[model samples]
Target: MEGQRSKVSSCSFVSYCFLFWVQLLPLATGGKVPALIVFGDSSVDAGNNNFIPTVARSNFEPYGRDFQGGKPTGRFSNGRVPTDFLSEAFRIKPYIPAYLDPKYNISDFATGVTFASAATGYDNATSEVLSVIPLWKQLEFYKTYQKNLRAYQGETTAKGTISEALHIMSLGTNDFLENYYTSPGRSTEYTPQQYEDFLVGIAGNFIRKLYGLGARKISLGGLPPMGCLPLERTTNVVGGNECVSRYNDVALEFNGKLKKLTTSLNKELPGIRLVFSNPYYSLMHIIRNPAEYGFDSTSVACCATGMFEMGYACSRGGMFSCSDASKYVFWDSFHPSEKTNGIIAAHLVKTALAQFLE
Candidate 1:
């Protein structure tokens, strides 16, 4: 049914790219990915922040201005986030609802749900800094969701469904920003290299835990080039308008470690399929050549001052915002606009999600 989507230019020409895949879903045997369950931070969060007490909330105007019905749903983008469009690729649903949203119907669970929280990360301390849900708590919530699913579909069916579903885990960026660099608790103990390894080790254990829970197709998003984001540029870019080399080096190092960890996990866990979604490279593609993606503004967000305004600063009563969000790559200082999210996800489906779709 996803192919039946109208040629609405408001959603853009890039969306049409998925129509071919959606049409083939019914004909494919195991080729079609059954579901897409997500876990991580704001990059893929739908509306989990609405239920929690955190400044990372995006459940307001301008955030979801381009989404269906024109209402914000806690997605950091001006429209659908990566998970929403990616779900459409599988004909999973128009959008995958948040796991914590009480309004989600029982049937919604059959397809997929996102368990990500804005600003949370692998380090418990990182989440603690923002009062958002910790990675550990998100896992507990997943256990609860599993029980609910079993209750809804009966144990046998739920088991089969979960085993076949695709899982997306994207976290750790905030660990570098909120913990490793700023928090005395972390900086006092480990060097940057040591901290990256520690994060990777803990994250690897988390992947193993998910595998134990019947997640056969698990994909993890690597850290984006944080230094290339608008926020980083505003704060750290020198006269040349170039990315902060130090931060990018850290992201590259962490991504390398992540790839190795996932490879080892795939080898150790029989029947397991682990994918590494390279947000770093995907983002770099756009950041390096914004014109190729049809974006005009990459230096500032579409909301507020667009320079440093994010989270609490981007509000309705105060600062101004751009009229057209599509032209911009970022919706805020730290998060990409919907168009950019779609571009990044299109790359992910071709690269990281290929095995799952096949």
Candidate 2:
């Protein structure tokens, strides 16, 4: 694959973007959405990790060279993330602001904001490993955001905004990666099936909490083909060019159960539109046949070593980055490139979110 090279970018963390179309550009979509409120991990985190007391932040070079101003914004991708694209799709704003960002005033909260923290997960132990925000803590931040919204916009308008906003969750990946697989404690305590059930329960509880917070339109992203990630490929026991089937088995099991959980929640929780967005289908679709999707490499990343380096390791002054990042599916060992995120977001909007659109 073209991603095996170890060259890197030479720019600083504060490069001014010459292109206006990167952030101000309007993306096309059929659905009319008011706002996008996002939660979960690095996948959807705009800059929540930057404010957090955690080293899991991506506020460094090469992290956002493709972003609005070509400056790092604490997103782990090569550029704009899924929520940014989803915001564009909804015509809410070019980028969803982080609630913790003091620079943006209350008017910025008119459209929804992101409460996601990079490296966070359903399990407290998962976030403990990385010293980032946990699921429960993220919920607390959501509560604070809601309180601010009510203060910023009168109670009635805030209530309507909370009910009408498109809420999205990109969680659970770290619960597996950082907890089940990496943590020796979890494996010793529970089997694979037991762990899956535990995480599903956590997810269910979180969704219920969101419903209680007046979130009506909720879309949760299921686990991707975790085995196919470059990091997983390198770490998987069944090594070679093939993906780790056992890891994917874990993800598949989780996705099926997660879908069932959402279905049950939708049936029981009256007036809540819960959707299980299975990213596995879209991710694997590109992996199995990269050429059709215009991707040149699916097994390797565009930054650093491509197989195992990311975040600080993928910085501009560190290792080599691909000349054409769009050709690769992954921006780093764990995160997808902006192109791949756009593709998956577009697919989800059309297939998953479109169905529930009013």
Candidate 3:
């Protein structure tokens, strides 16, 4: 009888410790954020473009030169992107793999995965321009991921992982830069304001769909200072190295609408934690004051001549490529350097991410 009583006490003690650990998890880490699920453009893309036939790909030398093993992994930057840093910040994992990568199976995805494709946007036309995966197709891939995850980890674990994961969407830049501004179709179809509204409408619906798919925590990234990009400054502001104020104004306006959309979504959807992550101010600050951010050049990228080179153009054979990428604000004409991405990620974790946890 005494032995049975001792066994019962031991079982009760083990149960108590398990409950205590579960309760301390949120406090020990940031929150109950289990995994980081990402969607959208090159800004957050892991390596989804590598599997697709697209000119927007950066899966070669000098791209991931600073990454582990100094080998390119299809990340646009010289190293890790913002999502990677965020994954580390949440204490989830060191790197978030691309969902389409054959190396990672359902078990790997049950932790975190990115459906983002370089050059893709909320507008399907933007993706068509470069033959990349459209937002809808990404959603389809996500559904498949869900099915596979359920099969591998059982329905309860899969459901909990999906619902507790932190979903991040970083798009819109490609829609404006690649589709609306560069391409004639969208510009002729709608004015800038109308285009902003159009994009926001799509974004709203996407968020709703994600919520329906069991995502409770979502972060939608707003547009950066597009005019400040090395490519934009080189092409838009002729004969000079000044940011195009007109383009910056458009980004600010779009961000305002996106912020409003997040607020509205939070109110409309019950039990949903939706927040807007504005990278504009942070990136602009880094550009305006490069020295403050330990950067030497803000006007041009570290790739080649830093005037007009990206993707295939920014190769290892390219002349005058900066030896130290940490000194440059941009790794390529169109994308921020890995260092810049890290800084922005840190800021988002402190501000926008805090709200999600709360």
- Best candidate according to TM-score: 1
Please give, for residues 87-156, the per-residue lDDT of candidate 3 as tens digits.
8777777679998899998778887899999999999999999999999999999999999988988999
Which candidate do you rate higher for TM-score, 1 or 3? 1
- Runs of candidate 3 exceeding 4 Å displacement: 1-27, 237-239, 316-319
Clashing pairs in 1: none
Cα deviation of 143 in candidate 3 (Å)? 0.7
Per residue, candidate 1 scores C-alpha lDDT tens digits across 245-336 of 88899999999999999899989999998988898988888888989878888887788877877776766522377766777888888899
- How well does each candidate superpose onto the true structure, as a TM-score? 0.93, 0.90, 0.91
Pairs that collide in candidate 3 are: none
Q: Indicate the worst ten consecutive residues by lDDT in candidate 1.
A: 1-10
Which ten residues in a row are the worst by lDDT in model 3?
Answer: 1-10
Q: lDDT scores for all predictions?
A: 0.82, 0.80, 0.84
lDDT of 2 at 224: 92
Order of candidate numbers by lDDT, starting with the best: 3, 1, 2
